[model samples]
Every structure is written in C-alpha cells, then in structure tokens.
Target chain A: MRTEEQANQAVEEYADLVRRLCFMRLKNREDSEDVFQTVFLKYLLYDGTFESAEHEKAWFIRITINSCKDSLRSVFRRRTLPLEVLSEEAAAVPEEHGALLEAVLSLPDHYKDAIYLFYYEGYSAVEIAEILGRKENTVYTWLSRGRALLRRRLGGDCL
Target chain B: MNQLQEALRGVAATQELKEWTRRRLVRERTRRRSAGRKGLAAAVCACLLCLLLGAGGYRFYMSPVSYISIDVNPSLELGLNAFDRVVQTVAYNDGGDEIAARLSLQNMPYQQAVDEVLSDQVFQSYAAQGNGVVFTVVSGDGARLQAGLEGCSGYYASGGHSYLADARCLDEAHTNGLSVGKYRAYLELSEYDPSVTVDDCHHMSMGELQQRLEQCHEGAQSTQGHGHGEHRHGHS
Candidate 1:
C-alpha cells in the first residue's frame, strides 16, 4: 500500500489525466467523478513499484480507463441522460470548444481513445497499443479510421 | 497545438475533485489499518485460549485419585488417576525398591499394573517360598475402591488376598514411611498388642504380620475362656 504522502502526490500528478479519460469514456459528470475517485483509491491501495514516470503514468491511465468502463457497465446508471442535462454538463468547458468536445464525445469509444491518446496525450500508435493491450497494427487501423471520422464530423481539413 | 489538444486541454480536473479524493484515500487507509490490527488481536486471543485449555487438560489427566498397594515381601504402591490408569509408583522398603526398579508400571491400568507386579520373577519367587501376598485398594470413593479390588482379584485370586480400605489413613501411612497396606496391617497388629510400633512392622513381611495377628487373637480367646471357667467354678 502507498503511504499517505505518496498517495497525495499521485492524486496531484494524475488528477488531470484521469479526469480527461473519465470525461471521454463516461461523459456524465457524476459518473466521471465516481470513476475519478475510484482510480485514486486504487492507486492508494496499489502495492507494485513503477519502473519509471512513464510506467507510473501508464498504470494510472489503464486503471482510469478500466474504472470508467466499469462505471458505464453499471446497471444502476442511467444509460442515456437527457440532452439538456448533457448540455448543462458540457457547459462546464469554454463555449468556443463546445462543438469540438461534443464531436469528440460523439465518436466511437475505440476511436475516442485512439484519437485522445494520439492527439491530446501525444502517445504514438505503438505506445498506445502497449497501454491499451492491443496489437500495433490494430492501433494504426483505429488511428486511421478515427481521423477519417473526426474529419467528417468536424467538416474541414482540421487534421 | 492541434485543435483537439486545445479543446481537450480545457477539460481538466477541478481543485475540489483532487482534494476530495485525497481526503477519502486517507480515511480508507486508516480503516484498513484498523481492521488489520483487529485481525491480529483476534489471532493472539485464539492461541492463548488453546494454550489454557491444553494446560488444564494435562493437569486433569495427571492428577491421581486412587491408590492400589501390592504387598508380598516387597511393598509397592500404584497411584491411579480418575481413568483407573496408574500415574505414580512408590516403594516403601528395600525389597519394594528392588521390585519397583524391575517394572515400568507408570500410566498402566491399575489391574494390569497389579498383574505385572504379581507376575514379576522376584514376587513369584517370594510367593513360591510360602509368603502371602495382599492387594489393597484405597480411595475416598467407595465404588472406585470396590471396582479396583474386584479388578485386581482376577489377576492373583489364588495366591493373594484383596481388601478395600479408606484413603483417609494415607497421609498418616506416608508420614511413617510405609505403604497403605503395611500401615493397615500395622494398625491391626497395634490394636492387638499396644507395644507394636510402625518401625517394627515396617520390616515385617505381610505373612509375619498375619501370623502375629492370629497368635494375638488366639491368646486373647484362650485367656477369656480360662477366666470364665474360674468364675463359674467359684460361683458353683
């Protein structure tokens, strides 16, 4: 188990990354908060040592993604929130990127993950494959298909 | 920066979320540590209870509740626990010590221990030379003493006599450095002849004690008969 100081450090360092992953995967602010808290609690209880900063960050990413998936699969969570509620949640960000955030959230789950890792987190296709436990070729395919979908959704050569 | 990166950068964790998660983690770590300490305390309590019960059981099993004294020329005694198993052996004389040295009677059943003593080569040789053997069961519990006498009589019915006695005299018997059987015989012989002492009787064999007791009874009877005849003749 991690000491209190170590746990606080981890929460401070990975809060933004875990929050982004949860927001991308769960969409609902309440469910994202739940997964966010769960991911840090898991970090506190995790006993293994990390090889490097990258390894530690990868561990946090994997745990956060899995936690979000678990939250989405919960039987008690409402499957489809009202559009007004989604709009209210989406209003948390700047108004200029509302369309872009909606476009990203509306993408297929695998494409959203591939695109976020590629464009936002700056992870290579091979590194994403290692983090997501996928074949390198499969990740390359997802990246290609994800970019095409994003181009169509945004209606420009934004890529 | 790409538009997607620019857009996603705006979606970051708030300060409230990080502070809330850190507080909850501290609480969870405290709760888990408390539970671990409780589990360890419970394990230690269980071990102590087992040790206490084991020690109590050993004491009960080793405490003697009855005694069986076998006296031929060698006066030896076996102390039995509640289960009728011998838990102690004592020798009262040099002959008794010699016989005790030749047998392993501890933890044997009283009846089996009697059989072993009666069947010993030295005891058999004494019996063969016309010495009388006596088996005495002494206990505060009458039923147990009766049962012990009956059990031992089966082993040496032909050559030995079986008797039951109270355990109250055991301390006095021990004080005089004698087995209960010898002490009992000493009591009877002292009654017949007040001059008899434990030291004198301690060295006497069971056969010699019995012989002296019979002679005392015979002398008392004859003297009473002769006095009655003299009184009747004077009255006539």
Candidate 2:
C-alpha cells in the first residue's frame, strides 16, 4: 500500500505526463482533465508493484492512453462531440501552432497517438507499441503514415 | 528534441492540475475505505444469515416424513406427514391430473398409497420412458433428508408395439438394479452391446453405462428381445 506522502508525490510527478497524454489523444481541455483525474485515481488503486521508475512511467503512459480511449468511446463522446466541438478545440489552440495541431488531430486516432508519442513525447516505436498495445511494426507503419499526412497538410519543409 | 517537440514540452502541468488531482485522490482513498467497511459489514451479515439458514434447514430436513413420489404415465410427488398421510401431492406433468382422478391418493401409508396407484389402469399404462417406472423414497428424522430412488424402464425390442414386453423390460432393469428413467434413454443402446448384463450395468452411472453400451463389437449383434426367452425378470 502506498502511503499518503507517496501518493502525493506520485500526483505531483506524473500529473503533467498524464495530462499531456490525455490532451494529445482527446484534443479537448474538458475531456483531458476528466481523463487526467481518472488515470491518477486508477494508479492509486492499482495493486501491482513496479520494478523501476521507467516501469512506473510506462504504467502511467499506458493507463493515461487507456483513459483517453475510454472517454472517446463513451456514449457522451459519441452523442455530444463532433465537428462543432472539434473546431472550438482547434480555435482554442495557439494560432502559431494551429496548423500543426489541426494536422495532428485530423489524422486517424492510431496515427495521431503514434505521432504524438514518437515526436513530442520522445518515445520509440517499440515503446509506443508497448504503450498502445500494438505490434511494433504496426506502430512503425502508423508513424510513417502519420508523418506523410502531416507533410501533406503542413508542407514537407515544416515536417 | 525537435523544435516542435521542445515547444510542446513548454505546455507544463499547472498548479491547479496538481491541486485538483491531490484532492480527488484523497477523496478516492476515503471513499474506498468507506466501501471497505461496508463490504466487511455485509460479509459478516451474510455469514450470520448462512449459519441461521443452515441450522433451520437441517432441522426441517430431519423431520420424520415419508416422501413417496408416485409416477404412473406422468409423475406425481407426494409428501407424507409424520402420520404417514398425504400432505402434499405435486404434479410434474399434465398426465399427473389423470392419475389424481383415478387414484384415492390421500391419507395412506407409503405401500398402501402405491397399491392404490397400481390399482388404477392409467397408472399401469404410465411408462416414464420405454415403460419405465420411477419410485423414489425420501425419509427424514427432522435434521437431514436422505433419498433412495429406483428408476426402472424396459428396453423394448418392439419399439413399444408390445406394452407387456416394455413393462417386462422395466421389471428386468429394476431387477438388475439399473436407474429406471435415466437408463431408459440407453434402451436402444443395449442392442449394441448385449454382452454387458443388466447386473453389470446396475450400479454404473448413466454416463458410464451410456459409454459402455455405446461400444458395439461387430455392428449390432442379433438378440432375443423382451418377449422371447425370459426377458422379464423378477425385482429383487
């Protein structure tokens, strides 16, 4: 069992990582915050012991992605969020990074997840595959396709 | 990291996000502890309830009662009270209504009630399956009820064309100590393995008998059926 002090430290350390993963997948502040809360609560309740900090980081990344997927598959997401909500989210992002964010979000879910974990979060395709529960080759394919889409949208120079 | 990756990393975890997560985790811990206590209380109550029920059920089960189930064509379950009188008669099928009409079933000893049932032509006509008859005896002393069932039916060669032959097969199986209704399903199967005697099959389980009887040595060996050569045997 984790002590109160340990639990506090975990929230402090992993909150940003979980938040970023959630934001990258969900692409909405409201949904990301909900997933962020869900991910940490699950981590606290998780009974398994970790071998190292890397293992612990992997755990947070995997669970945060799962939380984001769960929110996306939820009835509320299917019923409520659409082009209107997505456009609002696109508008909310900083205008400077607007095209990049739009291009990343416009890619299919798997490609978006792969590209974010690979480029932005500095995860290898092997690590991304482990996090996403896909074959490493599948992750590589997603990354290649995602980069191609990004180049098409933002031009090869920017990519 | 690339320029894009470096810029994205600048989107740091806010103080608000940290504080909110801390508060939520604390609430989750409290709620889990509360749920734990409730679960413990519920488990204790369940154990107590089980103990009480076990004791009460043991007593009711041991009470002196003769449970005579009368099955003619259809089956009728009779629960006899301490006085050996019919207190409850439950019909499992529609044919039981016919047995109820033909037999004066109330207020009789186990044997007497059986005699009363046998006296009815409808009772004689009732073949559980392949003219099989099931008589289960359930007795209790007010703590536990132990039941012994005798299920017997005929392995009719005549495909029920001969009612007497079918009854004889029932008698034959009962004499050999085979469970009547259950083994009736294996009636056609016996033709496959005629070497396995009824006595050999008597104590074997339904599945065992079915499996054993399933082994036909050389396709189907011809045999003298119920009517020919004393197929009817006396119940021991």
Candidate 3:
C-alpha cells in the first residue's frame, strides 16, 4: 500500500483537482466533500506505483471522477434540492466567477468533464479522451458543444 | 489566459477540505497497521500450538514404560511402551546381538515379539539341546507384568521359565552391562560364591548359571544333614 507520506503528498498535490471535479459533477459542497475524501482514501490504499508524475496525476483524475459518479448514482443523492440551496453551495468561488462556474456546472455531465479538463486543467482533446476513456472525436465534440452552451448562458465572447 | 480559465482557477479546494483528508488518511493507516499486527500475532500463536502438540505426541509414542528380558545363551531385552509394543532392543552378549540384528521386533506387540524370539532357528537349536531359557519381566505395574509373564511362558511351555522382577534392579543390571535375567542369575551365584562377578555371569550361558545354582543348593543341603546327624549323636 502507499505510505502515509505518499498519501499526504498526493492529497496536497491533487486536492484542488479532485474537489473541482467533484463539485462540477455533484453540484453541491456536501456531496463534493464526501467524494473528495473518498478519492484520497483510495489513493492511500492503492498498492501500485505510477510510472511518472503525469501518470500519477492521471490516476488521481480518473479515480476522483469515478468516485463522483458513484456518489451521484447513490439513492441518497438522487433526492431533489431547492435550486437556491444548490446555487448557494455551488457558488464557493469569487462573485465575478460564480456565473461562469454555474454555467459550467449546468452542462451535460460528459461535456462538463471535457470542458473542465480542456480549459481549466489545460489538457488537449486527446489527453482528455484518455483520462475520460472516450474517443478523441467524442471529447472534441463535447468541448465544442460545451463552449457554445457556455457562450449562450453568459451572452458574451468572454468564454 | 482565457476568461474561462481565469474564472475556473478561482474554484480551487479550500484549506479545511485538505486538512480533513490528511487527518483521515493518518487515521486509516493507523487502523490498518493495528489490524496487521493482530493477524501476525494470531498466526504465530497457531504455529506454536501445532509445534507443542507435535512434540507431545512424539514423546507419548516413543518413550518406554516396561521391559522384557529374554535370556538363554543369547541375552537381550525388549523395551515396551504403554501400549505393549516394542520400542527398543538391547543385546548384552554377542549371540544376543546377532539375534537382535536379525529380527525386526520394533513396534511388534510383546507377545508376538516373544513368539518370534522363541521360535528363532538359533534359539530353537539351543532349546532343542536342553538349554533352559529364562524370561524376566520388569514393570512398575504388577498386574501388567504378571500378564506379560503368563503370555511369555506359553511361548516356551516346556523349556523356559517366566517370572517377574523389580524395576529398580533393571537400572543396576544395566549399570553392570547385563540383562535383568542374567543379573538375577548373578545375584544367586554371588550368594554361593562371592568371587563370581557380574562380568563372569554375563559371559556364562543361562544353562551354566542354572547348573551352578543347583550345585550350590545341593552342597548346602548335604552340610546341613551332616551337622544334624553329628548333633543327635552327641545328645545320645
């Protein structure tokens, strides 16, 4: 199993990526926090070693996305919440970025993941395809459609 | 940077979440280490218990609790465990060594082993020549010793005598490098002639020892008769 030192180092390096992925998928702080903790715990128990820093970061990305998907699929998370409650929890960023963040969160799950990896994490369509286990063409389509939707929601060329 | 990249950069993880995850990982590692230690301890305990049982079983099966000394011209003893199976064999003379080397008596029941010894070709030849075979059984349990003697006597019904002896004398007999049967004969012969040592008796055949004992008895009887006659004549 990975040592405690390795676990601490992974959490420090990847916590932001995991939290942002969880928030985009689940759209609530409480469930995002749960999946975040679950992701780091899994890293601590994983016995295999990574080939490079890129491989390790890809591992964390895949695991965090999978954990978020599992949390969203749970019956407890299926319960509907007030729109105001969800918007208040999702608005953890600066006031000026809240609108853009909300628009990103509102996209289809596949497009949201593609957009986040492509724009914020600075991954190309090909790299995003590998991380999300999709064809490169599929990732490109998701990113293109996601940006068009974001432009419509914000109603400007700021995207 | 693009506008979206600059906006998304503001939505990073908070300090509280990172701290909570670090504390949780530490707690999980501790729990796993404790469970691993407990599993190791259980495995060690199981191995030690198996070793103890194995050693105890070996001792119970291999230790001897009784002995049967078969003495003719060949003097040897068979050591029996609690189940009356032969666990050891020791020869006190060259003939006995040959007989012991020729027979596979270990783990055989005492009665079957005695039959094997008595029916041996060399032993039968001596018996055929009218040499007396003596069986001396030594055991702490009286009833078991008597039962063993009875079973031994049946093997050589005419040419042998079977009797019980004290277990304590067995150690003394071994110290003098003799089987208990020969040792008993030595004790009797020593009474008649103090010059007769255990080594002399060890080399002597059982037939020679018996003959010498008989001569001693006759000499004592004749002396007593002559003394009584002389005393009666004086009284008259």
| lDDT (Cα, tens digit) per residue for candidate 3, span A68-130 | 655643412235444445555566677887778767766766788888888778899989877
| Worst lDDT 10-window in candidate 2 chain B | B143-152
Off by over 4 Å in 2: A75-78, A87-93, A157-159, B55-236
Model 2: per-residue Cα lDDT over B1-236, one tens digit each: 57456446545568998898889888878876887788688757755775789975444433435554443346566666654566656554466667776677665654456556655566555542322343434453211111011101121110111001133444544564442333343454444444555555444433354344323311111111111332111111
Query: Please, what is the TM-score per model?
Result: 0.51, 0.51, 0.50
Ranking by lDDT: 3, 1, 2
List candidate 3 segments past 4 Å from native.
Answer: A75-82, B42-236
lDDT of 1 at B84: 73
The parts of candidate 1 lying over 4 Å away from their true place are A75-80, B46-236
**lDDT (10s digit) by residue, model 1, range A1-159:** 689999999988999999889878775788889889877877776655677999889777766775665564341223434434544556666778877777776666667788899888999998998777556787899888877866777777664
Candidate 3 residue pairs in clash (backbone atoms < 3 Å): none
Ranking 2 against 3 by TM-score, winner: 2
Candidate 3's error at B20, in angstroms? 1.6
- Give the winner by lDDT: 2 or 3: 3
Task: Summarize candidate 1's per-residue lDDT along B1-236 as a digit string, tens digits.
Answer: 98877777777888998899889989988987896688578646655774788976566667888887888777888898866788989998787888889999888877778778877888777765544576667776533343334334323232454455566667788898888987877776676577888989877887788678656544543443233422111110
TM-score of 3: 0.50
Candidate 3, residue B36: how far the Cα is off, in Å: 2.0
Q: Supply candidate 2's per-residue lDDT for B14.
A: 80
